[model samples]
Target: MSPVAVILTALPVEYDAVRPYLTAPEEITLSDGTRLERGPLEGTPWTVALAELGEGALTTAILAKQIINELAPEALLFVGVAGGLKDDLQLGDVVVATKVYAVQGGKLTPEGHQERPESWHGSHRLVQAARSALRELRPDVRGHRKPIACGDVVLTDPDSDFAARLKRSYNDAHAIEMEGSGVAHAAHLSRQLDALVIRGISDFADPGKSAADSSGSQELAAGQAAKVAIAVLRKHQPAPEETPGPIYTGDHIDFSGGTFHGPVIGKQSRP
Candidate 1:
């Protein structure tokens, strides 16, 4: 069987950006009625399965596992838009997450809220493929391989407590999003699968986010992210499937008196 890769998105815009890159898409309805599209990724040797898993880490995690189990893909990628956290990242810039931080796990103490952070790194092979893909991207669309912080809240205030917590604890994260950590965790649990998260900076996680969305930044960001994701797929080559040795089902002959020239293989032998 050809190698398969699953691409998941959290929003319709993100899904739309990636849908165009698929050819001969056929819809697949899960047992729970969730729909997905599976097709060959244009210009690549991979069969891509795409789904729009609505917002939230928990929901994405559950659905991602279901999809993984159903499709048994070689790799999985979450492609979408995120709020930029770094000063240098601009709208439409793509970020390939080297790791995903689950920022919501913590403890509330008498002194203050204490953090019990959990994180999962992206597949090293996928990260290297993404690095190579970036070179083929447009010069204006900058790509970064950095950490991403994932949480449940839609962070729109730079001065908010959550934002401060992120700044203090996840200082290395370049982007904030809702689902990367969940997907990464699920992928990690699937020992045989590889996973990555690719996001485009749609806003700065500040008061200006609304304005940026109104100006169509989300669409642009989603498109840029989708491009990089497909490019990564092109650069990545899945491992070849092992060929099974020949099977002999006939009644085996006794080799006690015969001088065999080569090794004999059989399932059963009769004297």
Candidate 2:
């Protein structure tokens, strides 16, 4: 009886990528001064919402909670693009976040990026279901592929030492983005909703990665990522009475290092 909640950055390019399989959202404004335009996908009982971007985890959580108050979706999903952190990952790869990690100061010694020990819960079955759906939807693009990686990292100049620190965090971390961490935080704050963040690799964090082929690559990856995320949400039909646990609480929410201004439209990073 309740609706499904999905948060996507309010950009037309990103929206166009996922629009093929999803229905348009009905316009609604929340009490917290956030506006949402939402709709459901065709053939599936999935609902979507387009929320404003540029907020960090705290702001994202606040707005997400407001949306939840109104929509009461059984599951929450955040769909958008990310910057690939590894050389092996080219533009257009999709990443389904299994866990969310935060950065406190800058980069972590030895471990690369220091995760603030704060994490938002994600479902493995949901990520797997999305991956399986990708296999079914785009068999050609993903024939026998390796696992895609997802997580949050601070974005910095490609040539700067900051990026190098992020690179050292994980060998397989494919992408970086602004809102994934906040989105995760928001879903975790819901206290009664299942949440997932599915990101498409749009650009390599390295400056050398060409932008010539990235647009098309990102578009294709965005479609695949949206389709996969939608499938994951649809596959798990929770009982109407099911309620989420304490994972939604903000007890673990942390944003200590503060903010930085990177490339706004071209690259992804926290706000």
Candidate 3:
């Protein structure tokens, strides 16, 4: 059997679009009050654990920990719509984050704000799968493999101080959203997981947010992002390990655990 993937979203609207893509979907409520829609992808080799965790990285990080601990997914993909930050990225464009920046990290000094940012790059193998998935993207849909900024704030103005600050710090960010960093961090600590953030551009993150949102871009972008996600899954091939797949080895095959330093130090097989 193939491994499972947990797809996370922040809003109901985002969940609505992702839910339909799930096959044999059924709601499962955990003892901790965390709800999940578990199922499989029809043509893909991955089982799906889909959840809508309301909002914020804090909410998302806590829930992510619980879900991964219970489900033990092979990979975790945070899928949803984001406010496009780069000029070339337009509405409905899909961005697969090469790196996720937790943009809110910094310390205010007497002179100026000190840069103390935290960032996580996408899982190497998953990112390779995403790259292959790009070739299969719908012609109408444009996919960008780039960095994205994730924070708790919903940025509405491109000219806002926060926006300008982002440009100065994480200048390579292609889109802005509220969740990915949390999920990434959770996946980080749980060293045995592959993780990535996928977003569709719903708005320009400018003064035109209300206008673009009112025109149904959110739904369109969400759908497109979901499309790219399915594509990524289609391209993904899981390892057939009975235990947590080889992580410490040089192969890095399906590794899902906390930070790996040296090779397997004292771990031994049943002698």
Candidate 4:
């Protein structure tokens, strides 16, 4: 049977933002002890397979591969909050990644570290859907389509040496987050799985993270990201199963609901 999509989240806050769209939810337990919340999306033809996969690219890749093997969702969308890397992206804005850069790849040489970035492009179909959905969404919600850097390190200082290294190789990135590269890699390996990474800006990638959190930027950003995702979902209509074809990937999101008020919702799967 064909399922709608696989929605993966890194943190509980991110997971919570998208949970409300799933109705008639079911809980499934994997052999590895990871639990999944499976259900049909309200007013949509998709059965969303949702999970909070924790953090980091390694774990996310492993778990995403496992989920794809089990559910085989038509698309895999990673929703979460990220630190703003570009000046135009302010706290609470949304960013849909055109590509995810695995910035941690490289080797430390005798003189300095050399960058060897691993990148994965967002599925073209899926991304187009997001762009279409963007047109239908309210104009005031700031959103941008740009590249995002994915690394294991949490950057708190834009003036740090590590930040300098990132700027040298991936200066065009609009935001920074963890686990996007891992999920994109898993989708690449799957060949048929369409993957996208969507993030809400929560901080400036500087030292004032705690202050931002205290000011509820994370929550607001999360909700904004979720809102944009839902818009994509509303506009996206899954293509019918075609004759087995070549590599075609991108994000396509469609949303269905009433007014455009922003709020976050999600489910928790437990043993």
Best by lDDT: 1
Give the per-residue lDDT digits (tens) of candidate 2, residues 142-243: 321232233334453676765664555544445666666666777766675677777776666555335623447556666666666666666666544534
Better of 1 and 3 by TM-score: 1
Highest-scoring model, TM-score: 1
TM-score of every candidate: 0.90, 0.70, 0.87, 0.86
Models, CA RMSD each: 5.1, 15.4, 8.8, 14.3
Candidate 2, poorest ten consecutive residues by summed lDDT: 142-151
Candidate 3 shows a clash count of 7
RMSD score of candidate 1 (Å): 5.1
Kindly provide the TM-score of model 3 when superposed on the true structure, using C-alpha atoms. Answer: 0.87
If both were scored by TM-score, which would come out higher, candidate 3 or candidate 4?
3
Q: Rank the candidates by TM-score, best first.
A: 1, 3, 4, 2
Error (Å) of candidate 2 at residue 17 is: 2.7
Error of 4 at 91 (Å): 1.1
lDDT of 4 by residue, 30-147 (tens): 7787898988877777788889999999999999999988777788999999999887778888899999999987889998999888899998888998888776775856888899
Clashes of 1: 0
Query: What is the per-residue lDDT of model 1 for residues 190-244, given as tens digits with 9 covering 90 to 100?
Result: 9968899999999999999999999999999999999999999999988766544
| Stretches of candidate 4 exceeding 4 Å from the true structure | 242-271
Q: Select the stronger candidate by lDDT from 1 and 2.
A: 1
Judged by lDDT against the true structure, how good is candidate 2?
0.60
lDDT of 1: 0.92
